[model samples]
Target: MKKYRIGIVGATGAVGQEIISLLEKREFPVAEARLLASANSAGRQMQACGNLETIQETTADSFKDLDIAIFSAGSKQSLEFAEASRQHGCVVIDNSSAFRMDPLVPLVVPEINPDDLEKHQGIIANPNCSTAVALMGLYPLHKRFGLKRFIASTYQAVSGAGAAGFDALENELKAQFVPEENSSTATKDSPFPHPIAHNLLPHIDDFREDGYTKEELKMKNESRKILGNPSLKVSCTCVRVPVYRAHSISLSAEFSQPVNVPDAKAAIEGFNGAELWDLPNANRYPTPLQYAEKEDCGVGRIRIDQAFDNGLSLWVVGDQLWKGAALNAIQIAETLVEKKCLKWM
Candidate 1:
């Protein structure tokens, strides 16, 4: 096996750290690992793939020696440097929304559209975390029953907002235990509009003019792109939950073909990236805590929907960090390798 040189563009953050760990955990044949961050994080030392390396400030030349670069930096950074990395002969698997809808860049979920990778001119874009989780369950059913449209409600975790979001929740939880006099210690700079502890926020990304948040719209757009169903109507309500990790989605889908509980169970179980967890009698269903680190998204609560002639309701959960961000990017990288798309100079 060829060990390719790898770079993590935002190595100090949560998703970047997860990407590094997954590269090691999956034994992705990494010949070298480079950690790139902003100037502030430069000179910081971390160990990955059995070696300690200092994080380097990203420059135009950062991808010079890398065969592949997994980017978890925000959209602005990706937009600035993704093409630079590609020009340097590195394949970029970007985890931001910067180029997802670009006709040139492949918006990919390997389990659903690995073949789209071959068309990548330079970069491949990972879908929004919630969209990725929702599709893991929805795609299997879409395959078995021709999907027409879906309505989804997502219960997302704080970690999706990065370290600050996690810290805010921890601070809020700790404040409850402290005496009233110690209230000054509580901080409220959380990216969330209100406290995320014991409360739900009905927003994820910024709202579009149409009243849907960017997160909600991404599910609709990205699903259509991945499913090759531009006509696939998706109505989603994205909510941020108090969970520390993972994301859960409740989906009601209307398929062109009729759907049944038993057949839906078979479709979910038999699918590649999703597992059937519908044993409600055993209290067995996918939840944030249980599916927090698992690679396979779990689906359960499959039942015929009463609203439409061919509608079905289902519940799904998956680790946002795994299947959503890092794991999906790595899977795209793996697909590149398997397809022999990585050519040597």
Candidate 2:
């Protein structure tokens, strides 16, 4: 077993911090871990594997001598730094929309398309959170039954918007409970356009002229690429919920062949990286609160959808920061090593 010198861009952000925690928990053979953030966050210290590591400013030269760099920064940073990291001979796993639509770059989900890792040109793009969470349960079923169409409604958490979104939800909740000089003052500069404490916003990302949001379109396009089915039909309505972490999806999928409840449950249960919790008798089902802070996505509420003959309705919950972003990137990095695409540092 060999170790790799790893660097995490945007180390001070929420996803970046989760990457550090996951790398430690999974024992991913990291020889050295460098935390890099914006200039203001330089010299700030963060804990990784129980040792304090100082955050460095992200510059082109920062990637020198690094073997693997996991980037959770926004598109602006990824677009600016990804090529620089690759130019320094480092394998970059980017968790942003910057390169996902690139025909050359592989938009990957390890369990579904591990082979895509071999085609990477120094950078691999992690799928969006809503897309990732939906596919965690839907992909396995697609394998069992030929998937033709998919309609999903996402119950996304505030944390998906990063730290600012989380703070806004907290402040709103606190304002609702605590007395304030004026309620408006508490949520004057909320991260979201409206309150998220006791409300559900129908929009996730900016809406397009066609009525679908950017987040919703990511699900449609990314799913087709990952599934290798360009003709696949997918419609999604991504919503922002008040929860702190994790994301849930109500999926109704129609397959080429008829799928029964028992078969669907079996398909999900037998799949890797997914678990079935469809025990209606016990009133147990997947939820954001239950799957928060966990690795595996939970699938439950399995039943035949009444709308379509070959359709099944299922609910899935997964940690958006983990499987949706950090863990997925780490898994891709692991796949790169396992496939000999990247050498140990």
What TM-score goes with each of the models?
Answer: 0.96, 0.96
Clashing pairs in 1: none
Report the Cα lDDT for residue 100, model 1.
92
Q: How high a TM-score does candidate 2 get?
A: 0.96
Q: What is the alpha-carbon lDDT for the whole of candidate 2?
A: 0.89
Each candidate: how many clashes?
0, 0
In order, the Cα lDDT scores of the candidates are 0.89, 0.89
List, residue by residue over 117-218, the lDDT tens digit for candidate 1.
888887889999999999999998889999999999999999999878888888889877332542333256787876777778898989989899999999
**How do the residues 168-240 of candidate 2 rate in per-residue lDDT, one tens digit apiece?**
8987777674434434332666667767777778988799999999999999999999999988999999999
TM-score of 1: 0.96
